[model samples]
Target chain A: MNTTSILDIKNLHAGVAGKAILKGISLTIGPGEVHAVMGPNGSGKSTLAAVLAGREGYDITAGEARYLGQDLLELDPEERARAGLFLAFQYPVEIPGVNSTYFLKSALNEQRKHRGLPELDAIEFLKLVKEKIKLLDLNEDLLKRAVNVGFSGGEKKRNEIFQMAVLDPTLAVLDETDSGLDIDALRVVSEGVNKLKAPGKAQLVITHYQRLLNHIVPDYVHVLMEGRIVRSGGKELALELEERGYDWISRELQLAA
Target chain B: MSAVAPATVRPVEPATEVDPWVQPFARLESGALFPQQPAWVFPLRKAGLARFAELGLPTLAHEDWRFTNVAPLKGLPFAPTLAAPTQRLADGELDARPFARLPGDRLVFLDGHFVPGLSRVGTASGGGVVTSLAAAFRTHAGLLERHLTRYAHGSANPFTALNDAYFTDGALIHVPAGRVIEHPVQLVFVASGEEEGRAQHVRNLILAEAGSQFTVVEHYLGRGTATTVTNAVTEVVAADQVVMDHLKFQDESRAAYHFAAVHADLGRASQVNLHSFALGSRVSRHNIHTALNGEGLECVLNGLYLTDGDQLADHYMVVEHAQPHTASHEYFNGILEGRSRGVFHGRILVRPGAQKTDAKQTNKNLLLSDDATVNTKPQLEIYADDVKCTHGATVGQLPPEQIFYLRSRGLPLETARRMLIHAFAGEIIDRVRCAPLREELDRLVWDRLEQDTQIQVGPHA
Candidate 1:
C-alpha cells in the first residue's frame, strides 16, 4: 500500500491574455485517488485543466505545478504529455487526414520511447488496442477513421476515455468529461475511468455539475468559485452541492472575504 | 504571398531574337533519319521544323507562358542526342521509380533508344500491340501514319515541335476494339548518365478503338546525368465507348528539365482519366489539352506536384467541351518547399453548341516554407447556355491547430509536421484508383519526406 502523491499544485495563478483567472489555487492528489472539482459556469474550471495540460495562449502569472516531482510548467505540451500528463479536451479538434489508429500508435510509441523502453510491433499494438477498445464500448469502425472526424458528440468523449485506458497516464485531467454525455454514455465513460484506477495513478475530475461524480464516486469533492476553492469535503459534498447548488459556496466566500 | 493579392502581373518580355539552342537541334535533325516513313511524314516534319524556327522559344509576354520563365534553358546547350549513351543499367535498377513492374508489357527506352534487353513484353498480351515507335513505323506503317501527327499539331508549342522533329524512339500502344487489357502497358524513359546538357525527344501514342479499355503508365526518370532535358509528346485517340487511364510520372534529376504535352481526342461516351505526378526536375512544365468531340464524354485531369529546393513545376490544361452533355473535371494539388515555385493554369471552354456541359476546376497548393511561391489560376470561358462551370484556387500552409492537436498526443514537433505534410500530399495520392500503385506511391511520398525534409526526427528527452 504505497500511498505517495502523484500530483501537487501550489498557488497556481493562470489566465489568458493578461487577465487572471486562477487565484492561488492549491491542490494535491495521492495515488489511486479520484478528486472531483465542481464549479459553476465561468468558474475557471477549464482554465485550470488547460493550464495543467500546458495549453498555449495561457499566461501563467505565477504557479508551481509538479508531476512526479518534475517541473511541469517548464516542459512543452508534448513534453508534458511524454512526462505522463493527459488532458481530455473539452472540445476535441477534428484532425483531418490522420488515421486514428496511426495517431494513437505514434503517441504510445513516443511515450514508451521517452521511458527508454523498446517499441511495440504492429501485431502487439493491434492486440492491445482491440482489448482496450471494448472497455469504452466504442465501435471498431471509429478506430479505422480519421481522429474525431465525423464522430458524434458521445463518440468523441468515449474516444477521450479510450485513449486514457490505452496510454495509462500517471495523472489525467478530465475537463467537463460529462458535459455532453447522456446517461448511458456517462455510465460507460465512468465505468471506463473506474477501470483504470490503480496505485501510482490519480485523476482530477473537472465538471460543472455533480452528475459525473455520482458514477465515478470520487473520494473527495471540492467546490471552486471565482478563481478560488472555498470548500472541500468528502463525496457527500457533491450531493450537498447538487442539492443546494453553488450559491451556498459563493455566499460563504463573501462572508469569508 | 497572401491569397488576397491583386491579380496584376506585369508581363516580362523575353529576347525575340532566335535562341541559340534551336539551331543545334535543327542541325541534329538534319543528320537524323527515320526508320521508315511515308510521303506525309516529310510534310509533317517540315511543318514542325518551320514552326519551331518561326516560334523560337516562348516569351513571358505570351499569356500562356507568363508565370513559367524558360529563360534558364536558353543558356544550356541541349543538343538532341541521336546516338544512345554508353551508360547501361540493369533491369532491376528502376532508379527509385515506383510501380516498376506490370503483368502485361513494359517498354524500356534508354537515352531515347528502345532497349529490348531491359524490356519485357510477352506474347500473351495479344489483341493490343505494344512496341517501340521505331518498330511500329517500320511494321504497322499505316496505323502509325493515321494517328501520329493528326492530333498534336506541333505548331502550337515549340517543345512539341522539337519532339516531333527529333523523336528517335518511344512507345506505341494500340488496344483493339471490344478487348480489355488487364495489365498496364508500362513505359520507362531513362536519360542515361553522361548525357549532360543533352536532350531526349520521346513520342508516345495510344490508339484505343471502340469498346477498348487499358492503362498506360509513362515514367520519365533522370539520374546520373549532370544536366539533361526530356521533351516528350503523347497523343491518345480514345474511340467510342472506351476507357483509358493515362498516368505520367516525372522524376528527373533535380538539375534536369522536363517538358511534356498530352493531346487527346475523346469519342462519344469515352472516359479518359489523366494523372500527372511531378516529383523532380529543376524546371518542369506539362501542357495537357483534351478535345471532347463527341457528346457524353468524360475527361478527368488530375495532377499532384511535390517540389522542393530550386525546383519548379507547372501544369497547364485546356479542356474543350465541343459537344453537348460533356463533363470535364480538372483538379491539381501542389506542395512546395524551399525556394521552389509551382504554377497551375487550368481552362475549361464550352463551345456554342455545347449545352448541358458540366465542368469544374480546382487547384490547391501547400507551401511549407515562407520563400516558396505558387501562382494558380482556374479559368472558365463559356458561350453555351444551360451549362455549369466552377473553379477556385487556394494557396496555404498546414493548419497550426492540427499540429497542436497531434503534438498534444505526445508526437514530437517534427513528426507532427511531417505527418501533416504527408497527409496534405496524400489527399491527391489517394485518388489513384490503382491499389498497388497507390500503396507504392504512399510509401514513396513518405520516404521522400523522411529522406528529403529538413525536419529532424529522433528520440526526445
Candidate 2:
C-alpha cells in the first residue's frame, strides 16, 4: 500500500442491517488518480459510495478504510465532509425553502472553519460561486431558488458537480453522476469534474456505463462483481468491457476456479 | 358546643350563582360603560349581551373547541379594564413595541382604553380617517352605524359578543372612496400589567370604501407576567375595487390568555389580504372569517404560529364565496416544541350559483419534540357545480433525509436542523406583502427560535 494514497480499502465488508452487501472489497488510489468502479445494477456499487460517506444504517462488519491516512469509519458523515471528502449523490434530495446559495455558503464556511481558514462572507462566496457556476453551465437563478426543489434531472446532476466545484474537496466521489444526463449535460458535467481535478486531489468515479469514461478518462478501471473486485487493469479495460460486456469476465472467473 | 359552630354561621346560602366565567364580565356591561352611544347602538349591545349569555364559554365538548380546553379560565377572577392606568407611561414607551419605527399613524391603548398621551394621530395624506373607535362614534357615527358590529356579530363567537358589549376602545379606520392611504394604520395594545386578571375587550372597525386602498395592523403586547385576558373583535368592510391589507400580531406573556375574532366582508372586485402571527400567550385562539359577497373578489389568508413550553395556539378560519369568479388562498404554518400544541381548522364554503370559484388551503406543522403535537383539519363545502377547491394538512418532524443531505454538505447536524426549521417558517412569513414588516418578522422569529434550546434535534432524534 502506498503511504501517500488518497484512499485505501483492505478487504472491506459492509451490510445494511444483517444483510451483507459489499463483501471483501479492496482497492487503493494514489494522489491525482481517478479510479472508476464499474458494475451492473445491484452489484453494490452505491453501497460502496454510501459506506465511504458514512451514511447511517450501514454496518461495517469487517475491514479497514482509510481516507488521507485517517480512520474514515470513525468519523461522522459531516466530519468526513469537513475533512475534504465530497459525494455527488445520484439522487440529490430536494430541500424546500432552503436557498441554494445560503446552503452552499454554510457548507463552504464550515469546511473553511475546520481547516482554520477565515470564513467567506456573502460577497466573497458569491464571487467564488459565480466563477464555478459557469464551468457547469448552471443558471444563476437556480442559486437563488430552494435547494434542488424543482430542478430537472440533468440540472440536479449538474448541481452536484457544481457543489463539488464550490466546496473544492480533496477526494471527490461521483456516485453515478452520469445516470440521468443527456449528451450535452454529460459533456458539461464531465468538463466541470475535469476542471476540478488537481495534483493533490483525487476522485473515485462509480458508474455502470462506459460512455462516461469516454468523456473524463479514468486512470484505472476496476470491474466489480457481486461485491468484490474481480479484475483490475489500466484505462483500456473500460473500452474492452464496453465492447464485450461482463460475460467474458464471468467465464474467465469460472475457468480460474 | 359539641358541634363547635356558632349560630351566626348560618348554613351557607345555596343561592343562585352566576357562572364564575360570566359573572365578572356580565357585571361590566352596564349602560354606563358607553353612555354616549346612540339608542340604535344600545340594541346591538343588548343583542351582544344576550348572545353571550346564551353561548357562554366553550368547553371541550363543543366540536369546534375539542382540541382546546378553556376550563382554566373559570378559576381566574377577571375584571373589565374600564379606566387607564393611573401611572403615566414613561417616555418612548410605545416606541419599544414592534413596528414603532415604521412610518405610520398609531393608536395606543393601555389595558384596552385609548391613551391619547401615548398615541400619535395625524391627518391622513389621502383624506382618510384614522382615529380611536371612541372618537369615531362622535365623528363618523353614520359610518359606524352602517358598518360596526355588522360583520363580527355576537352569534358567531362568544369572545366577539363579549367584546361588542364591553370593548372600551379600539382603532376606527375609514379609507374614503377613491382615496389611498400610503402608510399603514397601526393599532397598538400594550398591557402594562398594572393588575392581574385584567380583562381587556377591544373592538376595531375598518371601512374601505369603493376604489380605496389601505393597510391596517392590530398588534397586542404584554409588558409583564400578569395573567391578563385580551378579547378583541375587528370588523372589516371593503367595497368594490378596494384593496385592503390587514395583519394581526399577538405576542403576549405566556401567562396571558388571548382571544380575537376578525370578520371581513369583501364586495365586488375587492382584494383583501389578511395575515396573522401568533408567537406568544399561554393559550391563544384566533377566529378569522372572510365572506366573498360579490364577483371578481380575491382574498388570501396567511398565518404563522410559534409556540413552546406548555403554551397552546389555535387558529380557526372560514372563507365563504357567495358570488362568481372569486378566488381565495390560505396558507398557515406552525412550529411547536417542548410540550406545546398547535391546532388549525380551515373551512372553505362555496354557495350555489357561485360559479368559477377558486379556493385552496394548506396547513403544515413542524413538531420539534416527541411530546409536542398538532391537530390540523382542512374542509370544503361546495354547493356550486363549477368550482375548484383543494386543501391538505400535514404534521411531522424534520425529514431525516433532508438533514443528512445538509450534513453531507459539511453543515453540522444542529445547524442543518435550524436551517430546515427556518425554511419551514419562511414558507409563510415570506408571503407578507409588506417588505419592511416581512423583514422585521423574519429577524424576530429567527431570534426567538435561536433562544430555544429545545428547537435542536435531540428529543426527536
Candidate 3:
C-alpha cells in the first residue's frame, strides 16, 4: 500500500519485576494500519502492551522499540503518553476523589502542552468531551462522578475507549478492551475506534476472541504464543485460527521449539 | 526553750487559717450573693469544686499531661462566670458559624451562660428533647440528676473536675425511644469578653433511648482579644439499637486554650460515630473514650487535625471493648505545616471476655515542612485470645510521583502541590458523613494550607 511506517519493534524481550514475559517479539506497524493480536491466556500479549506503555515494575531484558523515530524505552509512562502513545489498560486503575472530567482534561492538556498547543480551559474541554460522548452513547452524569470509582465492568471499558477518543494518540494500544463489553457496548466502542482512525494513525488491538475483530476489521493478524509471536498472516488468518481453536497452534509451536 | 525560742515554731497558729475550699468535707454554703440556683445542683457543684481544689491543675508530672505544659495557666486568675459578656458579637459574624443555616433546635451560650435571645428552638418532631441543662434540671430534675456527670466521674482528669464544678449552662439532648431526628441539633459556644484568663466550663449530655437515632454537632469559636480557656465535657449514652453521630468542630481563636473530653457508653446493638476536627487554638487537647459496655456494639472514632504557625494540637483516644462481639475503629490523620506540631495517641483495649472483638487503629501524618513535626503512637492491648486487633502509623510527606504527575499536566507548581495536599487530607474528609459540613471544612483547610510559602511539591523522584 506504500504507507509510511510509524512504529518499528524488533526483538522486544521484557518482563515484570525481573521475570521475563515478552520473549523476543518482533512487529512493525505502518501508518493507517490496524494489527490485531489474538492469543490464549498467558501468551505475553498484555506483557507486550505494558512494555510499550513503559509501566513501572517491569524490566526490559532486551528490546528495540522506536516510535516516531525516537527511543520509546527511555521515556517514563507519562512521558510515553505525552509522546502520542496510549495504552487502554485491561483493568483501569480506580482513582477515588479525582473527578472523571478533571482527570481527562488534565491528561488531554498535558498531551497538548507537550505538542506546543494552547491549553483548553474547563468550558472548552467540556464542549469537546460532549461531542465525543455522543459517539460512545455514554451518560453525561458519568463525567460528574469520580473516575471509575463505582462504574460497572462494561462501563469502565467504554470509558477507556472514550478516553482514547479524547486523547487521539498516534499509536493506540487496546489491551483487551473487549473483555467485559456487552454486544451493544462492543458495537459502540468499535464505532468509536473506527471514527478516530486517520491516515497518520495506527492501532494495535490485543484480544483473545474473534468477535471484536469482526467489527474493527484488522489489516494484519499476529498469533502470540508463549511470550513470542509464532505466526503472522493476512486478516483471514484470525478467522481460520478462531475456527480451528488454539490447541493446534500450541502443538505446532511446541513442535517447532 | 522560751528564752531561746525555736526559729521554726515560735507562734501559735489560728484554727480558721485553713482555706475553706481545701477541706475535703467542707460544704459550699451559698451566700445571699449566690444566684438562686436549684438546691439539688449545689451538692454536685460543691463536691466538684472541692475535688478540683484538692487536686489543683494538672502539671507535667502527671503521665497524661507529660507532653503538654500548663505553665501558662499558672499566671492567670480564673473565676466562675459572674461578670457580663464583654465582646458583643455581630449578627453576621455569629451567623457564619457552622450549622447556622440548618433548621434545627440550637442552644447558644456566651461565657458559660445561656443567651436565650440568640438561641432558637424548633418543634421537636422526632419526639426528642433539646434544652438548656439549667432549664432541664428544673424541669426534668430526676433524669438530669441520674445521667449528668455519670460516665465522666472517676475519669481522673482535672479538667473534667473543673468543668463539673462550674458549668452553669450546657446542652441537654434526649432522643426518645424509637424516634429518629432528621436534623442535627447544634450547640454553639462562643467565648467573648475582656476578662482575660477567664475560663468557660461547658458540659453536654446526650442520652439516646432504645431504638433511637440522632446527630449532634458541637462548635467552639472565640471572638475577643482576651485569652480564654474552654474546659468542655460531653457524655453520650446510647441504648439498645440506637445510633448516634457526634461531631466536634474546634476553631477557637489562636489566643485561646481548649481542653475537651468525650465519653460514650454504648449498649447492645448500638452504634456511635465520634468525629473531631481541630483547626485553631494555641494549645488544644481532645480525649475521647468509647466504652463498649454491651455486646454487639460498634464504635467508630474518626478525627483530623491541621496545625500551623507554632500551634499545637493533641488527640488522645481510648477504645474499651468490654463485651463480646463488639467492633471499634480509630482513624486519625494530621497535616502539620510551618513550625506547628501535632500529636496522636490511640490506645485500644480488649477485656478478657471480650471475644470476637474487631479493633483497628491507624494514625497518619503529613509533614508539609522540615520544621513541622508530628508524634504518633498506636497502642493495642488485647487480653482475649480470640480477638482480632491491628494498629499502624505512617508519617511522611506527599508522594512525589503523584505531585509530579499533576505538575507535568501544565499546572503551576503551587497549584499542583496544593492539589496533592488537598488529596491527602481528602482521604479523611471524604469519610465525613455530613455533606455540607464536609465541603465547608475542606475549603477552610485548603485555604489554611495555602498560607505556607515554603511547601515543596515534588520531593522524590
The candidate that achieves the highest DockQ relative to the unseen native structure? 2
Over B49-123, each residue of candidate 3 has an lDDT whose tens digit, in order, gives 656665666666555565666668656666555443655656566786666887777788888777787787755
lDDT of 2 at B440: 82
If both were scored by lDDT, which would come out higher, candidate 2 or candidate 3?
2
| Lowest-sum lDDT 10-residue window in model 3 chain B | B1-10
Predicted candidate 3 versus true structure: per-residue lDDT over A150-211, tens digit per residue: 88888888888888888888999999989989999899889999888999999999999988
lDDT of 2 at B216: 85
Residue B335's lDDT in candidate 2: 92
- The number of the candidate with the highest lDDT is 2
Worst 10 residues of 1 chain A by lDDT: A1-10
* Model 2 CA lDDT for position A97: 92
Cα lDDT tens digits, model 1, B182-231, are: 77778999887465678898989889889888788898887675788889
Tens digits of per-residue lDDT for model 2, A1-257: 56899899999999997998999999998889999999988889999999998888899999999999999999988999999999999999999999999999999999999999999999999999989999999999999999998999999999999999999999999999999899999999999999999999999999999999999899999999989999999899999999999889989999999
For model 3, the stretches where C-alpha displacement exceeds 4 angstroms are A1-94, A99-102, A105-162, A170-196, A202-257, B1-34, B50-56, B59-61, B79-84, B124-127, B193-195, B404-419, B446-461
Q: What DockQ would you assign to candidate 1?
A: 0.61
| Candidate 2 similarity to native, TM-score | 0.94
TM-score of chain B of 3: 0.89
